[model samples]
Target: MKAIFSWLNKPYYFNPKPLYKLKISIYHGLFIFLFLYIFRPFYLHEFDEIILPYTIGIGITAFVATFLILYLPALIFKDYFSEDNWTIGRNLLLMFVGVTFIGVALWYFGEIYKEPYNLRKINLLQFLSYTFLVSLIPLTFFVFLNEKNIRLRREKKVKEIRELKKVQELNNTEKLTKEVSITSENGKEKISFCIDNLVYVTSQGNYASFFIKKDDKINEKILRVTLAKIIAKLEKYPTIIRCHKSYIVNTNYITDISGNARGYLLKSKVIEIDIPVSRSFSKQSLLRLIS
Candidate 1:
């Protein structure tokens, strides 16, 4: 049964398609036919004339009929059981009863014709032996086949849920890294900035503008506080180092600090903005940038 399960799981490794599913079914079917042929065994001894032809014909027709009979249900019921959103016990009971009815149908048909093929002429011992070999073998194979599909579907669903959880976790982490702010009478107030996002604060008389970093994007927001007040408020944050009287910069964003006669340039952003770094503050800003 474990080998059967392994083969079914990797059908492509065995035969690329379900057409080849007949291979396993027919192999098992032939085994049952041979077992019954030896045990309860049909005898051509009763047919004196053309008995060989009769046996050959019966063998071919029975092989074809039994192949379609037992194998079709195995494939079809395995497919149905793959949709297993129902009780396993109920499905198993239904399958058992259905296969039992098939065995009874074979007995009924055998009984309809007298003597030659009449099941009534057959002794109880032979009938029971034949029924066990023909019916029970195929029925047991189908039960195992159905269970394999059920297990495969369960494994697939578990894998899909795990992948969904991974995607959801990634989305949550991305959401946390995005800046969210509120605009009110107090001016734009940021609840948080991604640790790597601070850029520079610029004066606009009584108001100040905060420049923040994004993914190759720059966002600026006007705050109600003056640049001096902004500097005082951010003083405790060691990264906020004054570049000029009008600008308090997040020194972490200072890629290069270039100084010339006219003024100093802060060269992190696309546009190299000139900042009038005072003699007193320039030294401190440069030291902070290197640190």
Candidate 2:
């Protein structure tokens, strides 16, 4: 029980794209439709004369209702369902609620068709309870599989980073005596620092802020330059890589490489925030650069 609870509390994958949401809704909708039409549950088979027509309409109804029940809350409460904080427990709760809503929709359809009340209203709470129960087991199984896959992927990435560690260490060692310079696009501003001491650079409207470590203290320097121009010059130094759209981090300064529901994140002691690894960036390249 404790192990299950811990696993459910851990992060689960989440994608914000409308296409991704649409796919999920479609999948659940199809499942409900197929299940209703094929099994004909709740005395659906007893209405021999009217059964065929009822099944056809109800199946379509289930499809549409399931789509709305599963898709709407995520669409409307997007912030509450962000990838960073989404967990398997929350997913389970959402599915449970969605299943309840599906039951309500199916019942209302039954009433509209004037289907026999062989069972009480709420079907004695059977459809919601039984449908959710049946689906829960399989859903939990798949969630476990997905969790394992994610952990394995994270572990593989860690190994890749470890394999590339020596190269980054060597580069950082050499940088202790070497200096790197960043010149603004307009040629009006420039900043230089011992390569090892430079921590990270972040893009601000038209300026770049450089974070540097000197004598155990952190310092910041700002120059009028776009991150694109800075990265062009910094590209020669493989250790300094752009982990996020607005942030470029020195591999030597990255103390942690972790992942949440969305994707990889880079963390540094000097920097207070976790830097996201956008889908636009090749994770393989980042792994190769970081020790």
Candidate 3:
């Protein structure tokens, strides 16, 4: 049973449109009408007594009416049949019940219509058997089409996520290899390091302190350069993000984050100091840190 209805497990059939339901009903009705007209099944005795046109008319009318009426339940209870929650066995049982109900109703209609004398002779069991057989073909097609649509959508989303991960990895690799050089205002002092090792930078008036990791130890170097100038030079590296007016942190080294009434504090495993994250940049800072 699982192998038989594996296709119906797709999410695409969960919330079908009213128009799509109508189309399915119409298509099923047409198939039923055509099959009965060609085969002239022994259970439907009216085809023997009545002319071809009247037989065709009655068959078309019965199928169209039955489909339209039965479709209401499918539409109303769609959530119960959704892929996230539905089971194949339960779905088949429900469909069987619906088809049986439709057959019984049609059989009653045949009993009431006295003009078609032969239709009144159809037994309840025979009518139900024919209805179930006709319903199976169309329902199978519906499930197959829905499953195909869902599989395509899932594949597309997975491909997009893979491409996005690849792009992020490339950017991270470039940032790790790229070296940045900071020079003093007088051009007499210079500091150079790879963007990946730089943990954070702090501004104190005319001096900018660089915090970096060397041989698994945190080290600091003071430069006679403005924080604004250093920030401008490091703009190309997205991991080296600004967290506060006076502090900029490398998101790569962020070990933990905490928030308080004052603001957020970012801690790095490489460094002993806790870096302040200002209120204005707190939300974005945390997002970058995690990403």
Q: Judging by lDDT against the true structure, name the best candidate.
A: 2
Ordering by lDDT? 2, 3, 1
Given candidate 3, what's the lDDT at residue 174?
47
lDDT of 3: 0.65
C-alpha positional error of residue 7 in candidate 1 after TM-score superposition, expressed in Å: 86
Using all chains and alpha carbons, the TM-scores for the candidates as numbered come to 0.33, 0.71, 0.44
What is the C-alpha lDDT profile of model 2 across 188-288, one tens digit per residue?
Answer: 76899987788888887788999999988889999999888888887877677887778888888777677544567777777787776765556566674
- What candidate 3 gets wrong by more than 4 Å, as runs, is 1-12, 43-71, 74-90, 114-120, 137-291
Candidate with more favorable, higher TM-score: 1 or 2: 2
Tens digit per residue, CA lDDT, model 1, 1-291: 986454433311111234565564455446544554445355535544544444344344445554564456556766443321223343445445544544454444444433464423665456556666666667557656655565465445434544543454232122224343423236556434653476777877667787777787778877666666556656766666777777877666665554432234466653357444544542433445421
Model 3, 1-291: lDDT tens digits are 776665334223233356665665576557656776677776554546553655455556655665655466666876665433444445556566766666676666556564545344657887677777777557656555655665565445434544554465433444466788999999998999988889899997789899888898878999998878888999887887777778888888876665432345677777777776655552333556533
lDDT of each: 0.51, 0.72, 0.65
Q: Is candidate 2 or candidate 3 better by lDDT?
A: 2
The TM-score obtained by model 3 is 0.44
